[model samples]
Target: MSPSASFSDVVRDRRAVRSFLDKAVPDDVLRAVLDEAQLAPSNSNTQPWIVHIARGTARDRLSEALLRADDEERYSLDFPYDGSAYEGAYARRRQDQAKALLDALGVSRDDEAGRRLAARRNLEFFGAPQVALLCVPGFAGARITADAGMYAQTFLLSLAARGLGGVAQTTIGFYADTVREALGLPDDHKLLFSMSFGYPDKRWTAQTPRTYRASLEESVHFHE
Candidate 1:
């Protein structure tokens, strides 16, 4: 960790790490990062996020389950995505991000097989040593999901602060049933997303792509 690291520096250094080294983070470091994430603000102090970390055999089992579910086309999501919602500017942004990622991976836009293989890497956690699944008890409403998003950001930032990296993957949430079954989670623990985290693999050239973000003028508004 650099002693001169500022908050902006940490945030700037963080990215959606697509590959990771096969290394188990020290227990103490993981615990400390989680402790920091626990301080993330929540509405009414509910702090409704439930996190499940998979490592060793557990991680392997979950990965296998997700892969099988994907192969079988068995998707049982707790919250289904509405593809139609991403229209116009939103759709364009999504497409641009996809193209950037595919280019970084050296996969042609028309290469269906290559794209499928790249998508499958999400299930494999990009060779990460550990995967953390975040959830909420009972049916997840928009408010709880928003709170969970906050928790997720704090968790990622915490990892960044410790010189670690993670990717928040909603793709895993599509196989919520498989994940819950593999992790032995109750039905009420609705899976939100998964974070595959560890030391970033510098050898993975695909991690070089930095996603584009809209300017503040395009995304934010002020009222006084």
Candidate 2:
């Protein structure tokens, strides 16, 4: 495929998959995806992404560790979500997302039990056969985080091109210290995020919700 066509197709087809099949991804395919991911640009060519791909026993161990961490209140990392700062369009968008998700899962607004059950699925890596943890060196700044985002986008797009599906999850970062300890990562490294990857389970019609994006006119400006 031509670069433009390939890029557009991947962007259009990619979804945040929550259900995965038992099928395992080949090592060669995973390596190629990582290779493409590493092509992402970075500040001063620092290229500061550290990726760890876990499968089989390692994947099970990581998931077990994450579940244990989730059970402990001390493991929670608080993120600031300023509702006041998210007024009008942004706030409505967020509400719509929640409603859509709940509707898809047959969860009522007051169904706290159902919500918790759904949240637990995140800890299970949504039954994906492969899980990739992304990290950066201890001394890296915000620029490195941006580079990591670019790398992750590349990886997700590459997976989409290969008919694989996954979700990039920052929830893994909440238990970063725990994950670092569990995975035997160096103390200086920070867990940036995790992604669950594998062939998506095609039977789940509830996964069909389409996320939206702002129009170019709303998101861009023409200086010329």
| TM-score of every candidate relative to the true structure | 0.96, 0.90
Q: Candidate 1 lDDT, tens digit per residue, 37-111?
A: 999999898999999999999999999999999999999889878767898889999999999999888899999
Error of 1 at 212 (Å): 1.4
Regions of model 1 farther than 4 Å from truth: 1-4, 205-207
Over 113-223, each residue of candidate 2 has an lDDT whose tens digit, in order, gives 998788878888999988998988877778888898999998898888888888998777788877777778887777888999989887763466877877899768999
Which lDDT value does model 1 have at 123?
Answer: 99
Whole-model lDDT per candidate = 0.91, 0.82
Best by TM-score: 1
In angstroms, give how far residue 152 of model 2 lies from its true place: 0.3
Query: What is candidate 1's local distance difference test score?
Result: 0.91
Angstrom error of the Cα, residue 35, model 2: value is: 1.0
